[model samples]
Structure formats: structure tokens, C-alpha cells
Target: MRLVTQQRALALTDRTSSRLASLQTLRSQIEHSGNLSPAAFKNQAEILLAFFPEIESIEWAPKIKSGSLDSFERRLQQTQAKTTQLTLSDSESSGIAFHLPIEYQHRHKHLPLQHPPGFDLIREAQWRDAIRSAIDRNMITSTRRYLAFAEDHPTDLIRLFLPVFQADTSQNQLRGLLSLELNVKRFIEQATQSNLAQAVPFEVYDNEDHNKIPLYHWPPAEIFSGLDSPLEHKTVVLPFADHEWTLVNVATPAFIQKYQNRLPIWLFVASLLCTIAVYVIVRITQSLAERLHEESNDRCWQLEQSNKALSNKMIEKGTFENALRESQDRLHDFIRISDDYFWELDTNHHFTYVSKQIVQFTGFPPTAMIGSSFLDMLHEEDSNSFRQALEKAIPKKRKIAIELRCKGHHNHWRWEKINVRPMFSTEGHCIGFRGISQDITDTKDELELLPETEPLLANESYGSAQQAINSVADQITSDRRFAQKLENFIHRHKATLDKTREAFFREALPEVAHELAALHEDAAEIGADKISELAGELKESHYKQAHREEQERLIEQLESHLEPMMDNINQSLHRQNPGSAGQKQA
Candidate 1:
């Protein structure tokens, strides 16, 4: 009977082994097929490993004699068949299938059929339908493998339950019931380094045909190893119809309590000494740890102080940067207001900081002006002097002034005076230079206003002669109002002459006055018409006339408009720079 039970255990193991091999095949195929990611395959592989450790705890029938068979029979029952199946997921509600019989389920099969293409899903592609059918068949095949073992053995129960408890397309209820979890709490509770144990699960399949059978477990732990010593055991029982079969759990003995030989008095004393040494070591370690903790805290404090100092330095640097920016902005505003430009030059004579006023000065951006020498804007004749001043400034570290007419950019001829002064670092070492250029065109214009040098002396004598004639005419005007006396005086002188006593023919003056008034009106009208006509011609000919012709016309107009002004100016000059007053003083 024992031999037969051993054979039965081997058979159950073979069935499970075959199923595991087939699962491996499925995993390999899924991997090489390139349909799943490496991570996904690894996750699925881990799930399979989770299922594997359960197999180690499986129990087989114990030793039995000819009479033991009857004892076992009395304990169990014959022909009490254990029926089990696997349920697989599909496009429709999955079905449960058996591989061999209802009594054993250690062997599982592949997947089963998918539902007919989702009514609408079919019309789209026949290929998808075929793929669905293939996957479904694989699942159904997996289901059958578990059924074979369940049909034969009563002990192989997980194969029967897990398929349904964790069936494909399972609801939450099945997942909770068939969780298949082992309560490792026992291993944790009654545990010591000397006594190690692991909680294991047992499942029972009650077959209707009560055939007494054995089952196999692999990769046995120390408790399960019959060769290992000092075994402790626990039993779990489930009642069948008219019989109850038991499952045995085993463990290792406590290593510390299991004494193999007697110890000498000296050895016992040495063991105690070792224990005291360990306690001393522990105390020293604790003291060292406390000291290390204190040192770490002190280091943290020092680091915090240094960090604060660094942060303050950063803030101070930021403030100084802002102040420098404000100063630069103010300097730029001053240059702009004065129609001036400034720049800095390194010893290599490249502009380091070109001011924005350069745009107004040269019609080019400051960026364009940088990297150019100060001589770049100088007139050809003044370049030598500008270079000389730059060289002189470098040695003396003094301000050097240069005057030059910059070439007209955008038709603007600006008279600029460059003032270059050497710059130095705080150590009084030559760093570079700063130079400001001012537009001095107005100064030049003021210089040109020396009226005493305008060559008016050549016209002075003619002006004096004309003034003499004008004085003589003024004297005649005062004496010219003598018409009333002139007529009588002329008559008396003629009468005194007594020669031509004939009546002086006195013609009527009335007709003559009216004719003279009519002549004056005609002359005024002619003059007014001529002035209007000339003004129209001048307006039409504007800009089209030759420059010389325009100038001539302007001169003629100026003579006409400024004759009175010239006379007034001459009178003022006569008062201020008066020749007669000087002559009288002489």
C-alpha cells in the first residue's frame, strides 16, 4: 500500500511538472513573439514565481501497512470523486473545462474559444477574429491541464480552486475568496534564530470516487526534509463524506536548545565571558555613535554660519551691481542731453563700454562703434594730433583734448572735441581709458561771428561821402519852403528892374493839379501790378532756378527789403562806432 501511495505521489508530481513546463513554453513564446515589453514579461514571470513556492508545501500520503490501508480507508473513503475545472477568459462569458476527469486537477491546459466577433467587430476583419480564436484556444488548453490532476487526487486542491477562484474574467468576489495567500504570521510569531519556520497552505480536493492517493512537493524546506533532524509538525484536517484526511505541516527544531554534548566547567565560564565582552562592545559602540552625532551637529552649525555669510555677500554684490547700473544710466542721460558720446578703451585701443549717445552722434548704434579706435572718426588732417594726444595721455595719465571735424555721417558734419583721460584701478595701475566727445559746432559758429573782420572798411569812405551829401540835402529842405515869398519877391524884383513891366502871365493852377493827381494814380497802379507779377514768377521758379541765379534774385530781394534796415544799422553804427564823434574828439 505504501509503494502504491509513493507511485501516486510521483504521478501527481509528473502532472504538475508537465503543466509548469507548458507554462514556461507559453512564457517563452510570448517573449520571442515580440508582442510584450521586457517589463511586462518580467511582471508576468514574477506572478508565476509567486505561484511556485506554494508547490513546496504540498503533502503526500504517509507510510502505511496492509492493515494501514484499512485504517486509512476507515479514515478516508473510496470512489468519493473530487471534481475540478479551470475557467478561462474570452470575448464572451468564459466556460469551465476539464482535461481528464472530475477527480483530479493538478494538470492545467491552455486558453479556450473567444466569442464570435463582436457582431460589429467581425465585419471589420476576419484576421482579428482568427487571432481571437487562437488566443481563446490557448487559454482553454491551459484550463484543461489543471483538470487532469483534480480528477484523480484529493490532496491536489489548489489546482481545482485557483482556476475558479482566480479564473480569467473574475469578479472581485472570486479574487477575495481564492486569494491563495499563506498566513506567514505563524512564522513571525513563534520564531527565533534557533527555531525557523514558514507558514504553508494546504488545499483539499474531495473526489466523489473516494480513491486514496498521494501527492508530491518539490524544493522541500528544512521542515519538509525527512533527512533533517528535530522536526516539529502541525496538522490541518478537512472532513470528507464518512472520512477525514489530514494535512501535515513541519518545521526545524530550535538550534540553541538542542544540545548535542555536555559542556566542561571551563568552557561554560568562557561562554559567559564572551557574552560579557559582547555587552562591553555594545556600550562602546553606543558611546562612539553619540560622539559622531554631536560632531555632525557641530559641522552642520558651522556650515550654516558659512552659508549665511555667503548669502550676505551675494546680497551685497547685488546691491552694488544695481548702484553701478544706476550710475551708468545717469552718465548716459548726461551725454545724451549734451549731444555728446563717450567710450572706454582698453590698452589695445578697443572700445570697452560705448555709450548710447553714440547713436545720436554717428547715426550708428553703440554696438557698431565698439572695437573701433578714436581716430576712426577724425578728419584726415587731425588724425595725427588725435593719435599724439592718445599716446601722451597714456604716459601722463592726464586729460588730453583734441579738436577735429568728424566726417559727415548721414550728411551731418559735427565739430567734436575729444577729451581723453586715463583710467586706473584702485591700485593706481593703468587699466584703460575713458573719453568724452562734445559737439562744439556752436563754439565754432561763435568764433565765426567776429564782425570787426568782415571787410566793411572799403565801403566806409563811400558811406561817409553819402552821409555828407545827405546832410547838405537836409539843409536845403529847411530853406526850400519859400514859394509864397518867392512869387512876391520875384514880382517886386521885376518891378524894381522897371524894364519888363508887362503883366507876368499868371496861369490857373487848378487844371494842372487835377492832371498831376491822375498821373500819380496811373504810376501807382503800374508799380503795384509789376510787383505782383514778379512775385508770381519767383514762386513758380523756386528750386528749379540755377544756384547762381537764385542767389542773384535773393540778393535783389534783400537789397529791396533791407535798404531801410541797412540805413538803421548804419545810424546805430554811426552812434556806436561813430566816425564824426571820433573826429570831433580828435
Candidate 2:
């Protein structure tokens, strides 16, 4: 009985795997053809249906851009091909950007179009997921159970979508989709048609992450009756695109009953022979015990070797920790040489700590700078503005940068730029400011000579350009009021607008006006801010532009040093030079 059951299981598995593999091969053939014409689509479906009769219908649902739909529809009409007219209702087309129009749908062994030519496949929820899966995975994907196409037969159906990419755009753009609808009930019947398979009942389930949900079962009613342990039976994993399905074949009640009825007679005959074999069994047991004792001794030697390996691993762990410490030391050395020095402040805006690099620029000891109020170091006029900015910035936790003149140890003022961000405590209370300050005295001196270094555009051209942009912005703002009046006029005289629309282009003028109004609104939305920004850029004097450029150059120089510090430390610890693979390895 065991031998017979194993043979039946193998037969069921072979049939199911072979069918799916053949369908996959057909998909490859269609995809490689380079052109997805209606004829090519229908031809492939016809061939698949011959081998896998369980497929109830096949469809070629091509995705069309909204801009191309009207022209594509007109081209179809010109061809004079047999088709049904399917237009979306006003509400259905709203807010949809693309349409999956069914170009060809064949069903029931015939090439008849089952749906209207342009019926949207994406409207159905299940088909929408199947479409998404195909595009996301770029492979054939199957949908969960959905209602069957035939109204009278309420059987569950599974749809699979294989994406077709356009040759011109290659894999980046999807040209269309090829889909198949399988009747689940018919699929089971076709799979288990053999007499051997029918003798034992089985079930097929979609195994998503090892969670089994019955796709089809024998005796049909067993599905609703529920399964306690589908995995307890003889289980097999049927691989599908991006998922696996579980196939379980079990012994039927009749097969079990027949086996039980023959079991008792065989047991009775075995009992009668048991006394005759007792002396022979004792001799065999003594030989087995001697073999077990030899194996136990071998296991003790293996355990002793494992202990030596553990001791070697501990030595390697110590070596790794030593290397880690060396890398950290190199990181601190890099930070010490950086020009931009770090500073931290208390909640009262008094410096709590400053890096030693600050002494190089200020000529003040690090200890002397500690506990000094940040505002007191700035020039008096700049200090008042800086304090007001910080007062507003703290509550909002805003990032800020300010220029100030600080007194050095020689009693000379040096220009500096400080960038700071508000820090917070674990409980979200305002803690203090943490920031980096860089000396910019040399940069400020060079920038002050910029007007003599570089020539500027003539004031005539710059001033006129600024005035022109500002004028256009004001005109657009005023035109928007007239646009509203045009809409109101059209709404108040709909009949007149409709008559004028038909007289001009056989379409409603009011509709045209509304579309034009939408276009105007879009123009206003885009033009206003863009013109204002242009005016500001044009009005920026030569001095302001030069000053901005100088600041950006200084920032780039500072970042160049900071960007590679960690990478340099890693290379140093690992004993590598630049332009070598060590930088790449890190």
C-alpha cells in the first residue's frame, strides 16, 4: 500500500510541475518575440490552451498612456476590425492616468472578444494587484482567488500576468500585459484525472511564507469543512513565480478501511511465530551493544578537539580589539588638526568646553575660554543682533549662522563665522547650543577687494531686467481676476456658450473655456513665484554676489578637510596609501 501511494504522489507532482513549466516556456517565447501584436498574443493563447485545457480564458491587456488612448482608438476603428464599444462613464475616468485596455480576450476555445474593446482591467481590485506584482517583480505573477468569468459557475479563478516590455524603450518601459485566467475547479479535475490519483484524495494550497490556504480540494465540500493540519500529510512544494504552493495527498477513508481490514490477520500470524525467534534475537542484541560502546568512546575524542579550537578563537578576539583601539587613536589625531573647532555651551549660552584648536586662532588658552558667555566675545553691534537671533531660534530649535568680530589675545578684532544648532535633552527639554566656529579673517579681507578684482554688468541692463520681471509678475496677478470673470460669464450663459461651441468646432465652447481657465490657473501657479525669484536674482548687486561666492568657497575648503578624515584614519590603521584599494575596501 505504501509503494502504491508513493507512485500516485509522484504521478500527481509530475503532471502539475510539467503543466506550469510548459506555461512558463510559452511566456518566454511571447516575451522574446519583440513585438506584441494582437495576432501574436492570440496565437500563444491558442497553443497554451491545447496543452493546458484548464485555462478558461486568455487576455492581452495592453497599457496605454492617457494621451495616446484617443488616437489609438481611432486607429482601431480605421482598421475596421470587429470590436465592441466600451467608454468609461464620467465618474470612472476621473483621476486615472493610465488605462489597461483589453485589446484581445479569447475564451471557450474560440477567438471571440469576451469584453468590450476598452474595458479597464485595472478597475477590478484583484487584477490591479496582479498587474502591480508583474511590474514590481518583472515576472509572471498569479492573483489570489477571484470570481470566475462564467456567471453561472461560481468557481474561484486565478489570473496570471506576464509583463511585455517595448523593444524601443527596452526593459525600462512596459508596453502591455499578457494574462491567463485559470478555472480552479477545472484545474483540479484535469490534474487528478488518472484512476490512481482519484483513489486517494488530495488538496492544493497557496503556500505564502509557509501559511497554507486551500486553493482546491477533492470532494469540494472538504474545503469549507476546514483542515486541521494540511502539512501533516505527504506534502510537496510547487514553486511558482515569487511564491511556492503546497500540494498534499492523503489516503482516502475507503483505502484506509481496506488496509485496516487486512491488518488483524497478518498480526495474528506474526504473534504465532514470535516464540520461535527469541533465541536468535538475544544473540543479535549482544552484538549491537558492543558496537554502541565503541561509538561512545570515539565521541569523547571529538569533544577534546573542540575545546582546543575554542582557545584559539579567544586569542583572535584579543587581536581584533587592539586593532580597533589603534583606529580610534588615528581619528582623534585627524580631529586635532582640523581648522573648524567644535564648541559646546550650557543652557545659559556660556561656553562649557572648546577644542584646543581654538587657541591657534584666538591665542587664548582653552581653560580661559571656558565659562565665557558667547555673546560677550562678539563686537557690541553684532552681539545685540546675535542675542536676538538666538532668543528666537532656541524655542523653534532652528539652525542659524552669524558673522561676528571677536577680540583676540593681542586686542585686535578678527571676523569669524559661527554655525550653531540647538541641542535637546533626553526628555526633550532645551539643553544648549552645540556648533562649529571657523576663523574667516583672511577670507573677509580678500572679499572686500572683490569689486576691483572682477568687472560688473552695466547698471542699464541689470536694472531694466529686474524691472521687467517685476512688471510681468504684477501683470499676471491682475490677469487672474479677469480669468475669474470669464468663468462666471460662461456659467451664467450656458445655452449661448453651447451654441457658439457647436458652431465653431462641433464641441461646447464653455467646456473649452473651462479647460483654458484650468490652463491659466496652472500658468499663474507656476509663473508668480518663478518671476519673483528671477527679479531677486537680477537685483542682487555685484558686491552682494561676490560676497556670497566668497562664503561658498570658504565652506568648500572646510568641507574638503572634514570629508576624508574618517576615511584617512581607516586607511592609516590598516596601513594603506591613497589611490590604492584600501580606500575602496574601507
Candidate 3:
């Protein structure tokens, strides 16, 4: 009997503890919705009903100001809900600063409560006090048992109050309140339905104030007399959200009678031992079967894990390959836009690959340059020297560099410098060479433009050299400026065509064409006939080619034509400084 009583007590404690913990969840539902309107409260109430069916009804009684009372009434009218029997009288509301009403309610089917839309709660002093306390304490508070008009008769009910406030409002400023109206008889019936509570009678009440009254009783019969005796029951205090409710559980008369009706205590102990022995024997047999089943499951689990690992590895490999391909594409794009071209040579020193940039640099397609020997493209005078350097460097797998002249598609010899490293296999056998080649003609011209002089400190020789170089640079800058002005003029007319196409052809085109014609005549007078010829081509193409295409074609031809004139000027500087040229040639 004592063991049975202990087991029931422990079970009741666990159930009560779980119920207390759920109070936070209940309070959170109210707090999370922010300011509750009818629709919002109804939605929350439906959620509570689904989660906790023991709840008879849920209510939201948000605080309303008397000043906003008319606005609040209009809002209620818009919802068109059923009205309550009484409205707040003007006299009653005069000093009432705030009015909390049942704005929303969701009632259970079995225990329905008709909470009309504007049922002001201020009339109920106990409810008013509980709400005020909850707001003051900034926590949940409960009212004593009260009679509710739910079933057309006075039904005993207790309400739990949780105050609401605007999230940004200070704690002392209460915005509204939420109330849960619990049917006392239904609540007790539900609590008593638990496995342990059915075997015992329990009563729950506030510990600090006996006058505050018990909230619920497990058995309806225990409501008045079952909690009267202290010697016959055990008590537990349920600490929940700033309030403590005392739980007193006592064995029922029927429970004690059933225990007494059992066989002698000694016989009961012997029977229990016999039953435990039989249970152990059955458990041994069950363990063997379970072991066999687990071994089969283990093999299947291993196969599944292996398959998943293989699938994951394949996914990782594919992702890595995709990333590598994207990086290669970006690298190729960089090479194409640059003034340099990448090249690769086989073991025989024959070109296996040349980048697309070769087209822009040498006026020769990359396809035409592939499979050609690197030595064949070099000027005859430098080929042997370059070949010797490669032969010495390849054997040691070292990087090599060489500057030589290559004939462009236009039959012009331009200087190019190649920087290369040998490619090797894992076994250390030389596979080929990979390198970048860049146009160095401009750099070579600048080097030739230097004055003929030996290295000197702050002396007259250094000053003279510096002045001479500056003079040549000024001439070069002047020539570049003229070329830039001509290009800008052509581009400006092309842009004008988009805005005034007919006017561009009639006025702008002829004016630019005549200017080029005059410039051509002036260039011939100056003995720069190459520049003269380029100007003549630009003037002639204005009538024969499309305006846009001709603009681009003329610009390219003019640039190419201007390069030779600049090169000639650089050569003239080199001739004036023979020692500088001689040093470069050596």
C-alpha cells in the first residue's frame, strides 16, 4: 500500500510539473502576437484549442482608453460580432481610466462560453484585481473561483491573467491583458483523468492566501471535505511564473480498500519473486532473437553508409572540376585582352599553341602560327644566339629569356621578347616549353632615344644628356598629341551620327573629309607622304564605306600609318647618338 502510494505521488508530481512548464508556452502565445485584434486573437485561440484541449476557452481582454472608447466601439461594430448584455455606462466609465473587454474568445464544443464582443471585465472585482496584480508584478496572475454565466446558469470558473504591453513600452506601462477562463469542473475532470490522479484525490490552491481559494480539485467529491485533514495527505508547491500553487494529494477510500482486500503480505511478496524469475527466463530467449536481427541490420547499414560516401565523393570531385574550368576560362580571357600572347613548344621546339592575341599583335591569325618552328620566325642574325640559349637552359630545366625580331603579316620586322620555362613529366623527362611573348618594339625605340654619354654624377655631361633626351621626348609627345587629336575628331563625328545621322553626312562628314584632304596636302608639303597617304584614304573611304565601319577602318589604318613615322623619328634620334645605338646593337 505504501509503495503504491509513493508511485502515485511521483506520477502526480511529474504531471503537475509538466503542466506548470506549459504555462510559459501559453503566455508566449499571447505575448508574441503583439497588439491583439479580433482576427489575431481568434487565430491564437484556435491554436491553443488544438494544442491543449483541456482548456475550456481562451480570451483576449486588451486595455482600452476611455478617450479612444468611441473608436474602439466602431472597430467592434466593423467586426459585427454578437453584443454583450451590458455596455459600459458613461457614469461607470467617468473615473475608470481603462476598460478591458472580452475582445475575442474561442470556446470548446462541449463547454461553450458565449463571450460577446464587448463584455467589459471591470465589473468583476476579482478579475480586475488579478489583472492589476499581473500588470504590477509584470507576470502571470490568477483569480479566485468565481461564478460565470456560461451554461445559462452560474458555473464555477477561475481565470488566469497575463498582462500585455507594447514591446517598446516600459514595464510599468501596461497596454492590455490576456485572460484564460477555465471551467473549474471540466478542468478538474481533465486533471483527474491522468493515470495517477485517477487513483488519488488532489486539490490545488494559492499557498500565500487561503482566502484566494483552490483553483481546482481532482475528484468532484473532494472539493469540500477531502482536503480538510492534514495527516491523510502529502503536499507539493507548484512554482509557476511569480506565483506558487500548493498541491495536496491523498489516497481515496477505494484505493486503500483495494490494497487491504489483497492476499496476506508474506504471500504477496513470494508471488512477486516467482513472477520476476519467470520474466528473467523469457527475457533471455528474447535477447538471442534480438541479437540475430541486429547483426543483419548492421550489414545493411554498412552497405548504405558506403554507398553514401561514394556518392558524396563524386559530388565533391565534380564541384572541384567545375571550379577549375571556370578559373581556366578567366585566365584565357585575361590573355586575350592583354598586349602579350602565350605560346607552347613541343620537344622539337615547334609551336604547338599560340594565343588569340597574336592576331591583334602581328596581323597573323593564331592558327597560322601554330606548328611553326620558333627559330624560323626569329631574325636570322639572332636565331643562332636564341637557339644556343635554349639548348643550354632546357638541359638544366631553367627559365630562359631572349629578344629577337619577328616578321609580321605586313612584312615588317618587330622586336619581341620571350620568357619561357620548361615543362616536365613526373619522371623528370622534358615534355615541352611554355612561355609568354610580348612586343618590345616601343621599349627598344625609347632605349635608342637616350643620349650618347657615359654614366656621370651631377656634372655637365649628365645635364646635357638629360636635356637632349627631354627634347626628343617633347617631339614624340607632340607627334602623339596630333595623332590623338585626329582620332578624337573622327570619334566625335561618329557619335554625332547617332543624334543627327543626315546632318552628320551632309555637314559633319564633308567638313571632316575636307579637313583630312587639307591635312594630307600639308603632310605632303612637309615630306611626310605616309601621313599624307593615310589622310587621303580616310577622305576617300567616307563615300564608299558605311559611316560606322569606315570610322573604325580609317582609325586602324591611321594608327598603323602613324607608327612608322614615330619609328623614323626614333631612328633619327638614334643616328644623332651613335654611341647609344652601338651599345644597343652590341
Candidate 4:
């Protein structure tokens, strides 16, 4: 029972240590990306907080220079739609050189807490000391217990400060502090919430400061009132961040009564029975002595046979080792000579190994790529497809081949074809993946350009459409009302086509297509063959792939044709009525 209780205490310690280490993920993200918007920070913080229920909140306090404070406050006011000031309490406090204000905070849904923007963290002594230690050492540091305000009241919370540094600066200047606030009592309860924990009450204390009270205690001390000392006590040291916590497990009187041992009573009863059986066994041994002597001589022959078998096994082991060495050598040689770079991913899809050839292809050395997530290298649009493909292949232990766009050096995107097989342990559990990626950017571009039939048809149709528009302008030159309407029609659609390719593709193209179809019917009703033919041709042209650069080029060409038509209409209007044209121009 004592052994079981000690093991549980050690397990809880390790669990807490691992949870603290996981906070580095958030710290690394802030360092790599620099400043994160409130929305982006909240999204990431919520993800991490979901895995750790003990964490009450995550806050980001950026290191605002004195010169930038006004601008920072102005930005916060605009975002929050309220007056925000960088507030500092106890301005007379000594050893306070700078102040950092909280800019973003994400708390648990159950905890209705609000650490509004511009709330300075440097006001508190403990938090200020922790922030200084984190920045100076460039490591994560923890503050002693502090009271954090919630909507209704205050709660005791311990905070960890992780320093973030500027990624692009040569000096590696401090950017901000990322903090995680946790309730130690709740953290311990969640970590040791098992059947064993119910029997073994425990208390956790900060070993660095023995004068301080226990960080968390399982049961109230009142339960042990008027009771005797504990039956057993054990302590386990848990190292996390910058401090050590000792988890002390105690087996009290109640625990002893609940799990009492009966081994002593059973041993005494077995001893008396053994004495009675000894006399009868002494008489029986004399008759078996001669038979045992004959069997001992036969055992010598069997031992000789076993020695020969052991010699045969040793020879087999040497041959197996030689074969294993040759296999590994061949694998290394293949990776060295291959033009396509090789990579290995752990079960979480993080890169564990990359060949030196990676530098030639992606312009990133093996060291830079290692330990980074494979999904981070992929383009946003392609990440989902790769994940879906991997999910389907993993269950069946099948190989997957996919083409994806990967972000290379300087943020340039390149298409790559990846062929990978899932690696498995001897027990048939999936361990990771080994793969080779070949650059296929040129091949993909060629395939996109292969469809020339549609472009040729489009060119012929656009030529006819341009000529028809010009012919309509000449025929309607004499009628002022008709010319005015034609001019308005051209300008309205031209304005719609002038937008960015992405905007036109997603929003303007559909409306323009519908209007052109209407124009085709109007021209046919007015008995204008040329105008009707042009509208019909345009309405029939395919514009499904609006995201393509080719679509943007087409819009530009159409606008060029409209420019000439607009010029011709203006000239015709001037020739038709010199007096009216001059008055309108004036």
C-alpha cells in the first residue's frame, strides 16, 4: 500500500512538470511571429488551455517603450471603443524602471474574468520581480501566489512568465511576456484525481521557500484533529520552470484502518502447521535418498547437450548483426545521392530528420527544419488536403502520395509531390513516417498552361465583341438619347471590371454575367444584330476560374476595348451637335 501511494505521488509530479513544459509552445509562437493580434492570441491560447484544465487564463503583456505608449493607448482605444490608459499603481515604489501593460487576455469560459487592456502588471511586486527574472535570464519564471480579480471577486492564482524576443532584430530585444495563470489547488486535484489519491492524502509545498505554506493540501487539516501521527509519509520532488515543488504523501489513521494488513496473523497459523508436518516428512526422506542419487548421474549428460546448443546460437547472432549493418549503410547511401530530399516525421507529424539535400531544394538547412511541424511548411490551402490524406492512409498502414504547395525561402510557394510510407514498430504500432519529396513546381505550371483550346476560342469571341461595340456606337451616333444610354452602359460595366481580380472573381463577375445576358435580350428586341452578337458571345464565355491570373488579364483586355469605344462615342456626340457638345463640355 505504501509503495502504491509513493508511485502515485511521483506520477503526479511528472504530470505537472510536463504540463509546464508544454507552455513553451505558446512562447515559441510569439517569438517566431512577433506580435500577435488579440484574436489570434486568443485562438491559440484557448487551444492550449483546453488541454490543461488547471490553467485559469493566459495573458500577453507587451513591452511598450515610453515613446510608443501614447500610440499603443490610442490603438487600444480604437479597438475597444473606450478610453484606455496605461495605469500604474504605487508609482513611488523603488527599483521600478519600466512598466508593461496587459494587451490581450484569454480566460476559461467558466471563469468570468476580465483583465482589460492597458492594465499594467508592473504594479505588483511579485509579478514585477518575475518579469525581470524572465527577461534577464531569457527563460520562463514563476511568481509566488497572487490574487487575481474576476468579475465577482478575487481568486488566488500562480502565474508563469515566459519571455518573448524579437525574431528579426540583431540584438534579440525583448518583445513581450506571455503569462499562464493557474490555480495550484485545482491543478493538484486534477492531476491526482484517482482511486489511489482518495486513500492517500497529499500536500505540495515549494521547496525553495520552506517558510511558505503548502501550495495545495488534499484534505482539510481538521480531519486529522485529535488523531495520532500518520502511519507513513513520503515526499517526491517535482522540478518545473524555475522552482522545485515537493509532493508529500501521508497515510493517516483513517487510511491505515481502511487498508489494514492480515499477513502477521496468517504467518503464525502457518508456522504451527509446518511443525506438525516436519516429523512425517523426516521418515519419508529416507526411502527417496537412493532414487535421488541415480537421477543426479543422468543430469550430467543433459548439461553437456545444452552447451552444444548455446554455441550454435552465438554464431547465428553474429550473422544477423552483419546483415543489419549492411541494410543501414545502403539506406544512408541512397539518401545521399537522391535529388529529392528525404524526411522523417514523428507520430504528431513533426519533422524528426531531414536530409542535407533539403538545403538545395527548400533553402532551409536540416537543423532549421528539424523539430518543426510538417503542416507548418505547407500552404494554408494545401494543409487540409494533406491532413485528410494522411488520416486515410494511417489506419490501413498504406503509403500516401500527394501534391501540395510548400512555402520555401523568402515566403515563396513551390509545389512538391510527396510519396511517403508509414513506419511501424515490431509490435505493429505506427511510429512515424518516412518520405521523399520531389519538386514539381515546373510540372504543375506546365499542366495549368496545357489547355490552349479555350483561350483560342475566347480570343476569337472577344475580337468579334470589340468590333460589334464599335459598330453600335457609329449606328447610334445621330440619336442623343440612345448614345447617352450606351455610354452609361459601358461605364457601369467598366467600373465593375476595374476591381481586383480576386474581388471581381468572387463578387463582381456573377453580377456582370447576369447583366450581359440581359443586354443580349435588349439588343435582340431593338433589332441590332451586331450588338446582340457581341452580348451573346460575352455571356457564353466561361469565367469559372476567376482566381486565375488569366482571368484578370482578360478583364484588363476587355477594359482596353471599352476605352476605345468610349473615345469613339465622345467624338460622335461632338460631331452630331457642336453647340450642345461644347455646352456640356463647359
**Could you tell me how far off, in angstroms, the CA of residue 115 lies in candidate 2 after the best superposition?**
4.8
Please give the CA lDDT of all the candidate structures.
0.40, 0.56, 0.59, 0.63
Q: Ten-residue segment with the worst summed lDDT in candidate 1?
A: 496-505
Candidate 3 residue runs with Cα over 4 Å from true position? 1-17, 25-53, 58-73, 81-113, 147-155, 164-178, 190-404, 408-410, 419-586
Angstrom error at residue 542, model 1: 74
Reference-based TM-score of each model: 0.25, 0.37, 0.40, 0.39
Please provide, for model 4 over 1-586, each residue's C-alpha lDDT reduced to its tens digit, 9 standing for 90 to 100. Answer: 3444454455465555555555665665666554477676777667667766678767676665655566766776567633212222223433323333334344445553344565555767777888779878988888877666666676667888877788778996767667777887677666555423245566777765546567776676533311133456766677767887776666677656764575344334433433333333333333333333343334444656677778778878888888999999998899888889989999899999999998977788999989999999899999999888887767545577899999887888999999998888988778989999999999989878886664322245335544544555566765657866654554444443333233453545555676667656654554545555655555454454434454444545544554555555555556666686566556
lDDT per residue for candidate 1 within 168-230, as digits (tens), equals 343422211011111122211211111111112121222322342222221123224322224
Candidate 2: give the clashing pairs.
none
- Model 3, 1-586: lDDT tens per residue? 3432333334334433443334444454445445446675566467556644556566555555556787766776676655222223232444322333444444534554345565556656766677667877877777776776655787776677776666555555555555666665665454334333134556667565567456666555546433466446776666544556666766556545765454255334534543443344335434533443464356557867998999999999999999999999999789868889899999888989999888866787889888988888788998898778877766545577788898776778889988998898988788888999889999999888878685434336325445545554555456756434433433333232132233232334555665567657756654557767877876676577556656555555665555544444445445455675445435
Worst 10 residues of 4 by lDDT: 82-91
Instruction: Give the winner by lDDT: 2 or 3.
Output: 3
Better of 1 and 3 by lDDT: 3
In terms of lDDT, model 1 sits at 0.40
Model 3 clashing residue pairs (backbone)? none
